[model samples]
Target: MNIKLSVVDQSPVHGSHAKIEAPRLTVELAQLCDSLGYHRFWVAEHHDSVHFANPCPEIMVASIASVTERIRVGSGGVMLSHYSPLKVAECFKMMATLHPDRIDLGVGRAPGGTGLTSHALAFPHEPHHGDLYAHQAQMLEGFVNGTLPADSPYSTIKVLPDSSPKPQLWMLGSSGGSAGLAGHLGYNLALARFIDPDNCNPAIFDSYAEAWKKAGHTGEPNRMLAIACICAETEEEAKLRAGTAVYRKLAAQMGQREDFLTPEQVQDRYKAMSTSEQAFYDHILKGYTVGTPDQCWQEIESLAYQFYCDEVSTVTVTHSHHDRMDSYRLLAKHL
Candidate 1:
């Protein structure tokens, strides 16, 4: 089937050396994906999280964009709730000015961290009182596109280095809650299926398209689906590599934060989990698209068709950097 393949890297902390290795590995993977003909390479933002390393995706986008020649580089999502919309617009606009047509500003509503980190981010300023995410998103879009209403408070202030080919704006969501809002704002939607695999709803895409048309958008409303995928030449090897991610996800669900373990170590820990924990682990395991190349492709194809999306972005994490790279390489080769 015809589809555009992309990548969303969380720069997952895999082994003991992740503190120094993970971020660098992201650039390396971007180079690989670019050469492999992947469409875009997006980095994620996190805060005070042991599982992910990079907290500032804007910087990573700059770094990745400088090194890769072809692949689009962007923030898989910036946690918009933590910063001023104007600041975000400035950062991404600067990146776009440097690398026109190659940067994407995908923003999400989540805090990207714990309650404590959220407080840290909002320190000195009282936490926002209401549902201001949508409002912030609107302001962000306005600032980037230079289209804020004339009556708006910030309309007189211009985003400097104004230039053509602004970074593509996207609303990243794990659920359908923001689909319509994204469309109404004329922004693309990127559904993060990896975050909540079982919650897939076709109505989300329908609502987005319907809203886009209602909003008088001229072209097709662009959308993408991001999936947690791990592919290998053999299914057994793929499942073995996925063991670490399964254990880590379940551990986080249970409120425990720890570094990734080996597949063998993960198996030992799995054997000790209680019945409920094991069931939860099983559910987590099922959420991932794990198998040989053809098997992974089949599931991805079906999911894209179901969601009415033509672009598929994969997020792969494994204990070994080579394994992680191989997973993406194999999937790209399959296509």
Candidate 2:
């Protein structure tokens, strides 16, 4: 089975690093991946997150697309529920005009930040917040094709400076509901396995594909799965560096999603965990790829087959930028 590899730069800010360094690091990673010939490099969107630094992925996409060649650069994705589709359409369409086939507009259903931020993003129009993503997606589709029902209010709107080869549209989701929607819309689906692996079951893939087939989508199903990895020269070294990810999962289990803890910081926390808690963390770790290059390759290949993935995107975070780059380099060698 052939599998394509991609990267998701979460822009994680280690306890010792400045938040400002995240964008620079992301750019460097994108350029490095371009040289390495990764299929795509995606920038994540986050707002007011203590660990992550990126607030706007489109700007990062523009920057990465400008600096790199061949590799597709996009939002891992834009949170549609929070923004105007017309504006998002304009921004990405203009980007597509410049970059042509290199642009991807991957829209997500998540809030992208704190609840307060989500509310603020829905300001001046709060009632529609519940069903906003569905509406946002519909308008985005209309604007992209330069078509909406003539009777619809938004039919008059047109994304300015349109060009051929508009940005490829994709749906980013972590749950069955969102996956089903992606299938319904006939958009390329990218599932976030790194978010909640236990819940991201094979059935979810079946669910998405079923919906896609039911929707009569004759085009090829563009399925990409995102998985976290901590590839190193040795399995022992990789596991040691993966403490941050383990702790991040532990924090998620504890209802705190902030990933400010480093491997050193997490050592005490990990020690303090009960045997059951440690076991739980280990189970989550097993879902992730944390080993040498060969090990990582095997894990990725297994996941690609499991999910029937045409492409697999990796999310890797380590304390040092150099080590992280080296991890990607080694993995790319195997791919």
lDDT of 2 by residue, 1-335 (tens): 88899998888886556777878888988999999989988888988887778889989999999999899888889988888888888888888888878988899888778788877777766735447687678788778877688998878765774434578889887766687887787778888888878788678878888888999979677889999999999998898788887777678668887646767777788788899988887888887889999999988998888888879999997877777898899998876
Best by TM-score: 1
Give model 2's TM-score versus the native structure.
0.94
RMSD of 2: 1.8
**Model 2, which residues run further than 4 Å from truth?**
127-130, 255-259
lDDT for predicted candidate 2 compared with the true structure: 0.83
Model 1 per-residue lDDT tens digits across residues 11-36: 98878464778899889899999999
What Cα-based lDDT does every candidate model obtain?
0.89, 0.83
lDDT of 2 at 114: 76
- Counted clashes in each candidate structure: 0, 0
Taking all chains together, each candidate's TM-score versus the true structure is 0.97, 0.94
